[model samples]
Target: MYRYTDFDTAFVAERNRQFRQQVRRRISGALTEDEFKPLRLMNGLYLQLHAYMLRVAIPYGTLNSAQMDQLALLAETWDKGYGHFTTRQNIQYNWPKLGDVPDMLDALAEVGLHAIQTSGNTIRNVTADHFAGGAADEIADPRPVAELLRQWSTDHPEFQFLPRKFKIAVTGSANDRAVIKAHDIGIQVVERDGQIGYRVLVGGGLGRTPMIGKELADFVPQADLLPYVEAVVSVWNLLGRRDNKYKARIKITVHEHGLDEIRALVESRFAETRAAFGGHDVALFEEIAAQFAPPAFRNAPTEVYDAAYATDPVFRAWADTNLSAHRIDGYAIAQISLKAHGETPGDASADQMRVMADIARRYGHDELRISHEQNVVLPHVHKSDLPAIHKILKANGLATANIGRISDIIACPGMDYCALATARSIPIAQEIATRFDELKIENDIGELKIKISGCINACGHHHVGHIGILGLDRAGVENYQITLGGDATETAALGERTGPGFSADDIVPAIERIVEAYLEHRSGREESFLETYRRLGMAPFKLALYGEETAKKARAA
Candidate 1:
């Protein structure tokens, strides 16, 4: 929700001008594909299999109604009439032309949004908790800090070309909804002896080498956050591997060089950088905070809300599933589900965006949010507005009543779209969600997370799901690998891989077996699937998935 200042606006305008010229050169054949690649990548454009993909940054997944309208306009005008929201809280358009991207960028700039740093091997978008400002349990809103880092890192000459892409996530709540530990740098806002500070974690990531980062600093005063962050990045920038892309992420660096050594190096750099610290940007933070101020709440019609809840079963189901905790008493966070059974996980049509925008203005507090899980949140909707909002949402195919259920999956654009992918992920996710819903097992089994990635890039946060599915190509055939017991909450842990990969035909049945095993092995309904998995280990799951004969043969061996 941070508004662009005059300076910010000017900078974006200038960047667009340069990119327009670059696009002209490419179209005119003055620049070759090789020459145009990095230039377009800098502006968040990628050449996909069928067309060019443009990833637009939605800073920390926060957007106003106007911004949502602009995204809808871009989708209608530029490429397809829809956009794909990603795990990093950004949106991607899969069908932008090479020449029309600059115009799209200009449209985004008009709304104080741009595609800058959405991709490339440089510092990407700084993400935080989607419910940053609205969470009732938050110590402070993390968006201002995210906004600060965004401005600091945007086109920073020193970090534009780092050894590998960097990601930073911040959360102000005790619950780690942002999956901070799976980021290159994770900052948690905490209180120490009555003073506000940050708990910093570095070198955590979820690619081939998934790791839960170790705490680097217990509590760093807020005033020193930027300088200390600079120190950490400077150390990594100087020492991180540049030759091998696979070994260049901070996670790899921390694995090779011990955490103690990296901590020491960061401390040394911090000592030097802290000495030269000019002053704190208190005024800037205040300015940013003002932009995100809470919307004015109106008195609600309590009787109307009670009557709707009492009368409408469909509205009741939606309220039970799609509504989230809000900071305000009379208000709630209404989630617009993109995971509507068999559709692509994050794809939203232009008309859906428009509907959401209208709902936000009419019922919500004029604030819209994009969850990391690829859903939209009307952050401050009054209880009395639930029926009307739900009606419009239902008309637009947005009322799914599945927020954290098995159907609500996070999937990356896999082999179908991504050039780097080895197999398809979206179809697999769709199949699984649809199967579970059809079987009527989603609610019966309770809360479960199933994340799928097309490859080992882990863009879907597969490594952190309760049930992680990784798709791979084996001799030109698609195969799926399952990992269980992963979590992304405060007690974050990477899932341990199960035995052998399953064929495409066998994957869904295997998942069903695993779920059935959890139910059979659980102590009671109170114990969830993960708790049962942790208690019994993978042995039962192996038997359930592959048959007891196979399990017995492996055990005998």
Candidate 2:
């Protein structure tokens, strides 16, 4: 993990001091809500339905034990007992008072973490693969470049306050675990002619108008990475729409003006931007890369892990679902599931956080990562430590044996916390999870992604889910719409809506119908829901959800 430099430390301290003053002004009525809105947003504070929510960034989802302990302390002392990890690899405190936000910011700064740029139209948190350094199939760790991008974008004068919020994600692996295709700018680390570089994709997003980004550059040399990125965002900053808030995103801009024109404009701007860099950015990247050098691996035996798997079915199930192949032999990437059955997805209690921190300190090389899917990751855990870690996680209610399964849902706060939401999303997610658990066939169903969003903002990443659910306010009633065949991997695609929507009460049953239909239509158990959906389009699923008569009537009409 990269330690904060003196400059980084001082910068955060100063920002906290300024925010403290701003918070005091707001509380004292010197600044009205309107006046304080942008100021607070810049520091990652939002006025939710009932309280002020603070979003703290976990850059590229990386953290150390000390930082995790601080976060746990913040959750225990200032706000509620738990914090919600978000799809952006950020954490949210849902009940912080206006007066306490400054103190919270200061507390975060103490641990070399901050809420800066977690919100606002400025470039948001630079996310990467959760298993950046530990994944077995990575080209190279993407965190160094991600950190470089973070340094370049944070408070950049020319790019601050763009038309709307921007997001960038990088993935070093070919598997695309970072959901790169759903970000404003997606960079995949690749090698061309034995030279490592980036394959840039622009205009990808999932809000009101969902789009899989177009390839901006097939391969941008690592030397020109920062300048090329700047050029792309700069072009979008100027060309993106400001007349309509809904149409202001770079995705919309790219949609309106074809990729060719956008590419041409970016190329034109790249010439000047690249010239001004003078190789300094590349030097800076080299410096950052040094900070992210891989941790020393232990030559631990995996005999214990094998024994545990053989004897304990519970540990075996969890290992089967939550563990991934690590780069180093005898090591495993352990995904701590926050989505424990019926609980609110991605929420970790203060005690649970502390337990995870302790486990990380003892067994996980003092490193932790937050996945974009909202799970905590111990990226480098020795296989010998599996049983002990699983025991602790189980005791803490953090062991859910469901990582990419149907029950491991990704859900936004929805109307319960978000003011922008039209309907309740959390309850819907809970209901579906509980229903699936009762069915007891989640493992049988295989790897399924069930993502739920309250509205069209797609904060839950519903657009790219294998089985996406979008909750809406339909004539004062909570309606849920389902989409199928959407994927977030390297071959990403936006899910297609399956006919009419269902009411909240009927949504779970509707989903069951779809699942049952998939089972019936699939070639075999080997074919997953997504694969079946892709092979046999939405017709079968629609027929299942709406009955044959309704499907026929709709088709006939």
Q: Each model's TM-score, in the order given? A: 0.98, 0.99
> Model 1's lDDT to the true fold?
0.89
Cα-based lDDT for every prediction: 0.89, 0.93
* Candidate with best lDDT: 2
Model 1 vs. true fold: TM:
0.98
Which candidate leads the pack in TM-score? 2
- Please, what are the lDDT tens digits per residue for candidate 2 over residues 235-319? 9999989899899989899999999999999999999999999999988999999998888888967899999999999999999
**Which residues of candidate 2, in runs, are more than 4 Å off?**
553-557
Worst 10 residues of 1 by lDDT: 276-285
Give me the displacement of residue 385 in model 1, in angstroms. 1.0
lDDT of residue 26 for candidate 2: 86
Q: What lDDT tens digits, residue by residue, belong to model 1 across residues 1-557? A: 67788999999999999999999999999999999998998999999888999999998888888999999999999977999999999999999988889899999998999999898878899888888778878999999899988988899899989998999999999999899999999999999889989999998999888999889999998888888999999999998999998899998888899999999999999988777666555557667778877778887666777898899899998888888888888778788999999999999999999999999888877788888888888878888888888889899899999888888999999999999898899999999988998898777787789999999999988999999999999999999999999998889999988878988888998999999898899999878888888888888888987888877875675
- Which segments of candidate 1 are over 4 A away from where they belong? 553-557
